[model samples]
Target: MTIPVKNTMDKKQAITAAIVVPLIICAAASVYFFVGSLEEEHEDNQTIVIVTIVPQQEFVEKVGGDKVRITVMVPPGASPHTYEPTPGIMKEVTKAEMYAKVGSGVEFENNLMEKIISNNRNMNIVDCSEGITKMGNDPHIWNSPVNAKIMVENICNGLVKIDPDNADYYTQNKDNYLEELDTLDKYIHHKLDGFSNRVFMTYHPSFGYFAKEYNLTQLAVEYGGKEPTPQVIQDSIDESTRYNLRYVFVAPQFAAEPCKTIARAIGGETASMDPLARNYTSNMKQIADSLALEFEE
Candidate 1:
């Protein structure tokens, strides 16, 4: 009787395990697959953003976080002033939900905005320079942290427009970035506060807005976006000599022809300064530090 009872009990346990173990594993697998599918769907649904410049890429990424996939029209080591978006770059417009343009006379935007829209009329346009008073035709608006904050707000607004569900997330990221930019502005002010000579000479006049923000004068060896002519070089040398400026800044994208020549004439040296730098905050700090070196001396 005991043996028959034990055998019956063992059969019952085996049948339960055969049914319940498979059921539990199937349920767990279904949940895992469901969650994985949802994650894949979410990733597949990310908003496509096309930006005109490298810094715009940063601005959009900071605000958009994982909600947006960005394509920068002007790649690094390329000047937006003279860059044209290739057909391949324009193709991105087809999928883009938004286009964040450095709309302040950036040659790339000015040249291709219409074509970009033509490719995708549904694409929302976000002007990064929306709130700032543009310094004439200068496209270097993001050079100033104050202007950068405005750009970031504009970017956040665009992200919200494209992905309203994540508006709060975009807004929070923008707030954090704005705080960092404010700190950067204060740090630059503190670093350059007591400098008597507020003049900086560069190969390109890319820092006009930044110089204006910080009460500094930006002298350019490259005149009117062209390599400096003889007279322009002489004038730049004279200007730097007047301010006792010690360094002439040049970027990787532009020819340093007159920068070095002017530096030699003015008894200074040519140094690197990229206004279109992707690492905006750190680049600005580097700029401040470079200026501080010259100013401190």
Candidate 2:
């Protein structure tokens, strides 16, 4: 329709309208797809199952691949030592088809396994620590590579029993992963071989299993299943200094400040290690490397 209009103004308005109309339509379509995708993702998240406990959860995901859904029971950054289960956590355990337990001093001190069984009577609770050998029932069985292999096998077996159809899949995964574990064991031994009569101190006594495997001595700062008192701290500092220790091992989930203070007091440094790391191979490698660097110097 040719109406009287300011020539340049009319042309500019027409161009603007032409550009804006398609842009609005395209934006609306894009929003529709984005919302649809979100909805699909939400549904997928709902369908996936959850696993409790960090170590077990990690092992399950490794062996299960995309076939299994897992959620860790302990929240990240929470101390498993003092973590207490809530009603909501128990509900999750109840819904879980299987439960993977470490059955160590940490969980026992916190009283975790009883809570899971008390809540979920029907759910199969598999002790990944089964068949684990301890020099004297040392709770840190998961620390050693050989013991970790046993744990992975235990997890794979649990998965098979839970989902029988996937037995072969889990078995195949177990066989492949076991070789990597054996490699880790060899690497650890090789690194540790340089240090005979090597000794270190830790905040918690969680490294006994690791130390035992490598013939190293780990003297814990907190001895009586309690946090160190002033006297205990002083005594530990003295002991570490006496040995001319190079590194003081600290766990990620625990407060390293006290240990750092002790290390500084004794003119030594602190090394952070994860007692509850999910990746078995990576965790072992890190520990071995840290120890080698610290002890060799």
Candidate 3:
């Protein structure tokens, strides 16, 4: 018994529908899963990190690579001694999974630590200055490459704690950055080697740690974090004369008038030096170069 042409056509259409419907459903399911996976990957790839200064931001970027989103509390040209965070910054802090504090008793940290902890109760707080030798309450621990090595170690530990899956990546990056820092240390030493004058002058006492590291003395025009008195200015002039210093280092965060005056009094020039610079290696090298210029025999 032969089937009619219409009957055969109906059977063929039914078979095609059965095969295509399942295939279309499978394709849609695959697409859904692919999109969901991409979203999950994107979420897993990034972490929100908070830092108190630009240098700390650099450290985080070095170790965290593309995995971190940094929010620096102390912007460039603003002294950490007097920085006040806005409500928006606090809101950003609340969203951060980690807060890498300078942790060396900077005035801003002293004032904002409580609020920062309150804002993000569960955020991991990493003290970047944990093992560094303090300079009589000096908070510029990152100034010394030796101290910076410790800070980077602390930063890496904090990163590993929060993101264990990426621990190896963080460790590798930390190692690489540390090697660079070591090279920086050696370069500074090489530049300042065999120098006649080991003393340098600055507007602010920002380079105490750097001075300590390189066996140099940093004389500041400012005293007790205050503007120079007439006597202090005279004293600085006398010291500059005595040391025969050729340059006075001025930072962008502070007024340069005092440094310029002292420099002029001693017939020297004022040079810009930023200890809070974001480019860690280059900043140190530049500082070394500036000091080298003054100390050239």
Which candidate achieves the best lDDT against the true structure?
A: 3
Structure candidate 3, residue pairs in collision: none
For candidate 1, give the lDDT of residue 271. 89
Assess each prediction's global lDDT (C-alpha) against the native. 0.86, 0.76, 0.90
Q: Per-candidate TM vs. native?
A: 0.85, 0.79, 0.85
Off by over 4 Å in 1: 1-42
Report the CA-based lDDT of candidate 2 relative to the real structure: 0.76
**Cα error of candidate 3 at position 242, Å:** 0.4
What tens-digit string does per-residue lDDT give for candidate 1 at 72-140? 888999987678777888788898999888879888777778988999999989988898998777788
lDDT of 3 at 2: 57
- Estimate the TM-score for candidate 1: 0.85
- Assess the local accuracy of residue 254 in candidate 2 as a C-alpha lDDT between 0 and 100: 78
Q: Rank order by TM-score, top first?
A: 3, 1, 2
Cα RMSD of all models vs. native, in order, equals: 5.9, 4.6, 7.0
| Model 3 agreement with the true structure over 1-297: per-residue lDDT tens digits | 356988999999999999999999999999999999998888657889999999888899999998888999988889998889888998998889999999998999999899899988999999998888798877888999999999999999999999999999999999999999999999999999778689988988888999888899999888567878888989999998898888888999988888788888889899999988988889889989888889986
TM-score of 3: 0.85
